[model samples]
Target: MGKTVKLYVHWVDTFNRWVGRFAMRLIFVMAAIMLYAIFSRLFLGRPVNWVMEMSQFLLVSYYLLGGAYSMQLDAHVRMDLFYGRLSAKKRAVTDAFTILFVIFYLGVLAWGGFSSTEYAWSYNQKNYTSWAPPMWPVKAIMTFGIILMLLQAISAFFKDVAIARGRPIA
Candidate 1:
């Protein structure tokens, strides 16, 4: 309800929205590239060597970047069998508790990812393919994505905690 908290929520939501929009648009690009690769290989009889690697990286980036946005929408999978039966306050409490585990898991992921990205950057690691794309960018994106997911989780946890306490989330 406070101005600061509201501002933060708006900021987070806005960032996720932008990311989601970019990712969605990138899907079209991915499709176009795939079509071109397929057509060129089949018709022109010359396979594009970089196409596979590029597509793989783009797919990874798409999912990683869209994770926080999906979380914001609560689009991630969950077992609805028992969860669906819970009261609102109880569900909120359960969600808050469940997120504790997620926080710990993402903490470890972010730490390891950051270290890996740093090593990649320092060594200038590259893929074994002829394209030999630098690995640091994707690794860095992984770390950044995990951080974004963590922030989204924290926001959700706060909202759930408020709901569990019967507070109106203004």
Candidate 2:
């Protein structure tokens, strides 16, 4: 049992590290986009056509993709003072409820976001600028990110259940 837990922990750690790397890369990608936009505006006669919106889209994508990584590491913000003192079963219950609440919220976000994205796509959405691209692709980020975040939350809640059952979370 210990060996199995250790193997799972090792795998989880590997996944955590991989996701961290990707998150960092996304950060750099956003920064590069901003710099390029600034350079284009400063050095060229034309400013970056859609850089601001593109950067924002990249950032949303990063947060959605990076959320699971944060959850895996137990790095997310939570008020855990009493939580640490709770019995394992109690802790599991709390964790489960918390995640269920999050799931509800994410479900709302996903539904609404999907509707907006669909509307945009169906209408051949465009930006306000001359280089306007279809806005649906950008809008889709909300749905994707929220869904992924909800999945990670569900996974973490189950992890707590496992822990309460005397099984290792990993």
Candidate 3:
């Protein structure tokens, strides 16, 4: 492999690993927020105004940002019936092809999301809610998240290619 490709793979892998670890905390934060909301509503006789909106934001952010991490860990759901039976080389080949499709899909989303995020930032768009939180952050997150996923996909592609060619990836 070229030095540039190896560098990219290393960098993307490192970034995804770090970010994925950080993202695990988001689940706890989301859970805490929900617990607070539940307690406040039941005991205090009023729901938290920002709970729903905050949860939506947290959930989306968690899913989008943590995608690369999930991919790295091979934690994403898949039909394992046939896949599990495949040999290492076959599995690598299959993964490479599927990752190509994922790259294309994420590329499209990232492209559109970038434009939308730019528009939101320029216009200072805000969600139409009682909280009226600015939407640009989430939009930016969506764009950036997809980009990260793409980078991680490239890293995975290289590893799979190595496996397919019977080469040591590391």
lDDT scores in order: 0.85, 0.75, 0.89
Q: Where does candidate 2 stray beyond 4 Å?
A: 1-20
Could you give candidate 1's per-residue lDDT for residues 1-170 as a string of tens digits?
Answer: 46676677677878987887787676777888899999999999988888887788788778878898999899999989899999999999999999989988888999999999999999999999888999999898888888888878877887788789888465
- 1 or 3, greater by TM-score: 1
- Per-residue lDDT of 6-70 in model 3, one digit per residue for the tens? 88888898999888888778888999999999999999988888988888888888888899989
In model 1, the number of clashes is 0
TM-score on alpha carbons, each prediction? 0.92, 0.78, 0.91
Clashing pairs in 1: none
Position 83, candidate 2: lDDT: 90
The model with the greatest TM-score is: 1
User: Which is the better candidate, 2 or 3, if ranked by lDDT?
Assistant: 3
- Summed backbone clashes in each candidate are 0, 0, 0
Please give the TM-score that candidate 2 achieves against the real structure: 0.78
Poorest stretch of ten by lDDT in candidate 1: 1-10
Tens digit per residue, CA lDDT, model 2, 71-151: 767789988779999887888878877888887888888899899999999999898777787888878866766666666
Higher-TM-score candidate among 1 and 2? 1
Off by over 4 Å in 3: 42-46
Sort order, lDDT high to low: 3, 1, 2
